[model samples]
Target chain A: MDEIRIFAPATVANLSCGFDVLGCCLDTVGDEMLIKKNDLGEVRITKLTGQDLPLETDQNVAGVAAKSLLGELGSKQGFDIEIYKKIKAGSGIGSSAASSAGVVFAINKLVGEPFSPEQLIPFAMEGERLASGNAHADNVAPALLGGFSLVKSYDPLEVISLPSPAELRMVVLHPLIEIKTKDSRSIIKQNVSLKKAISQWGNLGAFVSALYTEDYALLGRSLQDEVVEPIRSILIPYFDDLKQVAMDKGALGFGISGSGPSVFALCKGNDIAQNVKTAINEFYKAKAIDFELHLSEINTEGIKILE
Target chain B: MDEIRIFAPATVANLSCGFDVLGCCLDTVGDEMLIKKNDLGEVRITKLTGQDLPLETDQNVAGVAAKSLLGELGSKQGFDIEIYKKIKAGSGIGSSAASSAGVVFAINKLVGEPFSPEQLIPFAMEGERLASGNAHADNVAPALLGGFSLVKSYDPLEVISLPSPAELRMVVLHPLIEIKTKDSRSIIKQNVSLKKAISQWGNLGAFVSALYTEDYALLGRSLQDEVVEPIRSILIPYFDDLKQVAMDKGALGFGISGSGPSVFALCKGNDIAQNVKTAINEFYKAKAIDFELHLSEINTEGIKILE
Candidate 1:
């Protein structure tokens, strides 16, 4: 009971038209955290692997999130945390969220689950703040709660877990390129025309309805982003071309995942997902760019205990 | 058949967060039209009742819509049209849509229904142009297709019919004050901050999801409209007070319906809808303003043949 291991999955935020609101978890790639009691009464990252992430408790997202949870719990109990990072940093697949959500999820379990999943969001968002300058929960919510999550409001931190269709599959391609979250976010305009905003909201409504009805065609038609994607997609190399190739290959919908360098295409079945992956691989191969492709069913169980 | 009769239900457009994209039909109020063939080879309005709507074909929404449909059908056949309007003009509850949609629906049937319900939208929207000077279909689509409708796109004219919850009921209040569509629209800002747009889109996504899953609580929570309501509600007297009363009386959600003077509240059952209606009536009575209240279930059948 004094030690626990938790795995937090990668997440796709935005989902094209649902910027800053919608996100879903991925089953194939994630981060693992091992938490063990320590005598020093301090929360610390004792070990790290796969990437050169900060070891400092204050600087690390996992540490920050754990510290926030501990601060709320008013517990001085010490813990040594080991992070086995599988989701790559700057891959735009919610790497920081996996870390932040992983620690709090593990800590909550170790402490007999004092906080509900919704209650755990602010703590994870605090960790997200350490990783990125903004305290946003689009990625962390899904990574912590499993399946699709909507950050309906951030001020009071209202997160809703949405239903995931059984037939849904995802094809994510990480282009092995780094795109700083802050830089990608800074490029977006502060104001948008009311016209485009209306169009975006309409698409978002249709997209959410499609998810509930399991109407894949409607979902595909609603996967458009006329606002954020148009501006942010310019930062990614061949984003337009990649999206076209994915759609032409029968992806129900495709768009930049999170902030970019990683793009995801959703499909109805595994065969189409494989086809999309191959098409994307062929495109990247033609350009001789190293890329990683992960084909997965939606991770309905966002973070889970590791046996 | 030498003649045909059709009824087009009234609709509530701009369902809060969905502004200009979402709408639903009402069962209790609508417009009725009768079309009879003649040898004159001309479309003419032979009779009008309930309201003094424009009789000239170009000036009338119903007449304009009928002409648009007939032009597409390449039918030179003459027709005498009779209109019996029950939905009040400038009520902000798709009065024009009921008229416009009624004629197109009647003519489509009289000519053997050459257009699918969806295909009839543009012609109906053409009718909408005669009324609003803009070819918008938020009201017309729902009036034609029944139930709830989302105008997903306007360029290629994509309209989606959303599933309406069986328990959903509506209470619409017309305050007898006129707010011109142009004036109401002119009051809104052309641009909105990205922050507000994100919140609006999130609510929109949640609202649509709620409709499909029949999650009444979620639907109520998602009925917020920070973008348009804040600006337009100022035009309606006691709008804030009426909305508060409706919510207090167990209405799921309340907001200005389209360009106001009229406001609608959604409730889970007929009893709550009646309670909301009584509350609204009390509010108007206190102010000594003449008002009309209509309580009804959502019209699942938008336009229907009058037997």
Candidate 2:
């Protein structure tokens, strides 16, 4: 196949209790990308719409990601790419991850599928590096592998995909604001108390078990972040009020998605998610803020073919 | 049910990568107890053998645990307890936990079981509180619930029992040296770098997943301790050498069991465990250290009825 059209789904990273190690895919929100092979021996972003991003190969997450994959294989195979962005940049819902993971996924398919979905992760992570200062796997991993993904280790780059409960729904709230990855990360302390660290790991362990057992309440109880959230949540507008409302609306758990500007309320079923979305809307609407709400089921499949 | 004789299996707590929250029950290393209902409305220790311990109900761990269970139930029923101590007190394995969990287990059985085995955890933890200053449930939870247990929280006191692979075995090396839990704990820094904490939680999250999947190799990789081991291992003699030989001889993972003096090497099968045990034995014998070694399978039944 010389050309491939695909849907690169959005992802929620920096999960509560899980912090930098866990992420889950979103089904309803994503960007559409079209890639076609070119014999010119060059990677280029020929078309870009919906959001104004750089067209330079090195500057664009997709271009960087696609080049990483091609460079790894030593293939002179070039590709012309077009990204129709639906998920806005700096929304903190893995905007760059979608474009990055999406391009590598599409190119791998175009090049006779030399790499499996899981194998495409490292190249996708290059996009993450270009987007965020760190080459963290949390966002790109779940975006490629789908479901709930755990980054077991970083040196080896081992990521394990966990099974998501059938009824799990994510209600995402994005306020029209930008939180730069650098500035957002700067506020967090370099050190944490061991007491809080123990609590975080215990909750993280229980949270993983909850995923296996599909214990919704247990999952909610384990969705606590003792390390980063207390400091970073202040950067987002009304983070506390939103979390309180989400929990009161019977969300299984709630936390800042990635670094912030986007928040997710994890619910057991679509009905509760819809209710959470409605409650969050009504609560946030009262404030002088423009926000968007999305209710989505856990995406079992990561990226998908559009045509 | 007037007279009950039981085997209270020992447990390995403060597992690698797990630290304060994880533990597993052992099959062969434990203590035997004979508990009998008394006509007098008072708890008493009629006989104690194999070790010098306090006989007073309040001073004895078994007595404290038994009393805690009775006090919670508000039952006037009393019992005469006999403990034949086998597991050494400061061996890092759950010695106090065995005695503490055993009597409550036996008394519960004698009184037609007012509480389930899992319910007996809190009372058993009272014994832990008497033995140590903290009422940590890592040891006692597994001593009651069997197999592997994760102490999800200390405040609300939630414990989760996890599965163990069929062939899993533990080779425990109790070097004939005593290191008090308080002294062992003091050396660890109350604060840790965020980078190390992230690595710890990442490994812990993966370790929990490994338990569910019964992936032994993955379990080996996940058995890492960045926060506690470096400081604590200094308390144990030739700690690095022993771990090296155990790993070289094909043990799945190795680390300090609970605190110090006693270390455990986790192996996948009986054959590998035996090999690891032999290697460790040989390594320790050359040194001027006197040690006792025990090889045990994962005890799915925490406390057993011997007769």
Candidate 3:
């Protein structure tokens, strides 16, 4: 096929105690990209929709990722790309990751799947570097591979897919405020006490075990970020109150999504997820903040083809 | 029965990346305790063997743990305790944990198990405090609960048992040099950079997942210790060379056990475990250091009754 369309899911990185290592995909909020071969042999962003993002090939994450993949294949074959973005940029929900991963995924398919999903990570990470200064794969890995992912090492780029409980559901609340990724990251302290580091790793280890055993209570208890959240949460409005409200309304756990302006809570069932969403909405209303809420199950199939 | 004998297995704490949070039990080396009920309402250490340890009840870890359990149970009954220490002190193999946990296990049995294994953690921790100033439970938790364990929190004391693969074996080598727990702990820097902490937590999350999923290769890769080992390994002789030799000899992973002097390597099967042990022994012999080596499977049973 000379043309293909693919959907890449939004991802939640950091995952409380996991910091830069853990992430999972969301089923509903994502970006769709359509790719068609061009005779000019130049990769270009022909059209865009839903959000105002850069259309320049070098400036856009999707274009950059697609160009990187084509360069790896050593093909002069160019492609015209169209991005239909649903995940909002600066929402801390991996909007850029969806664009980057979605394009590489579609292009890989257009070339008869010369590279595996794992091989596409570096190209996608290059796109992430364009969006943010750092080449982090936490968001892109889950967006490309699906379910939950652990970026075990970034130096050699090792990513591992973790088991996600079938009953797990996520409630995401996006406040209509922008928090730049660079500013969000700059607020964090460069050093932490050794004692606190130990505590964080303990929770991280327990969290991974809980995922494997499907122990909901253990998972909830392990959703603590003693190191990062304490510093970064100050930048987000009503962060503490929102989390407390969600917890009181039966969210298993709650925390900021990625950097800020967006927050998420994990619940075991659809009913509790709905309750959490309502609770978050009520909190937002009382504070007089415009917001959007989305309830979704863990996206097991990350990126998919659409005719 | 008015009298009982119990054996608490040795443990390897800090398991590389996990530092104050993770530990696993070793099968063969342990401390055995014998407790006999007496009419006098006072706990006493009656006899000792195998090692020169404190005989005063209040100063000893076993005596301290037994007293704590009795206090919790509010029992007026007294006991005469006999200690047979097989695990060497200051060897970085949870010697104090074996002693502390063994007495609690025997005393609980004598009183018809007034506390579940997990409930005995606080008492064992009390014993550990008598050994080390800090009431750290990494070693004690694994000794009390068996197999691999994660101490998720210490304030309220939450400990969770992680699954261990059936084929997992450990080769522990004690180089016969004493690295005092206080000295071993003091060498570590009080503060760690956020970047290093993130790396350590990443490995820890992957390591826990590896344990549950039984991914041996992943487990090996995740055994990296960027935070603690770099500092503590300086105290151990030939630490780097020994680890390289172990890895070259087909061992899955190698790192300092707890602090220093004692180092352990993880291997997949019995043959590889034997090879690792032999390789460590040859390395020690060439260095002209007195050492002891033990090959063991992961102790599924932490503390056991002796008939």
Reference-based lDDT, each prediction: 0.89, 0.92, 0.89
Question: What is the per-residue lDDT of model 3 for residues A16-93, given as tens digits with 9 covering 90 to 100?
Answer: 988888889999888888999999999999999999989899999988888899898899999999999888898999
**Residue B229 CA displacement from its true place in model 2, Å:** 0.6
Q: What is the interface RMSD of each candidate, in Å?
A: 1.0, 0.5, 0.7
Model 1 chain B lowest lDDT segment of ten:
B127-136
Per-residue alpha-carbon lDDT of candidate 2 for residues B1-307, written as tens digits (9 for 90 to 100): 7999999998999788998999999999999999999989889999988778899999999999999999999999989999999998888898899999999999999988879888899999999898888788899989998999999888888999888989889999999899877778888999999999999999999999999998999889999999999999998999999999999999889999998779999999989999999999889999998999999999998999985
Model 1: per-residue Cα lDDT at residue B198 = 94
Residue pairs with colliding backbones in model 2 are: none
Which residue pairs clash in candidate 1? A146-A302
lDDT of 3 by residue, B1-307 (tens): 9998888788999989889999999998888888899999988999988888898999988889889999988999999999888888899999988888888878888889888999888898888898878788989889988999999988768999998899999999998899988888888899999999998988999899899889998889889988989889998889999999899888889998986679999999999988888888887898878888999999988998889
DockQ of 1: 0.79
In model 3, the runs with Cα more than 4 Å from the true position are none
lDDT of 3 at A263: 87
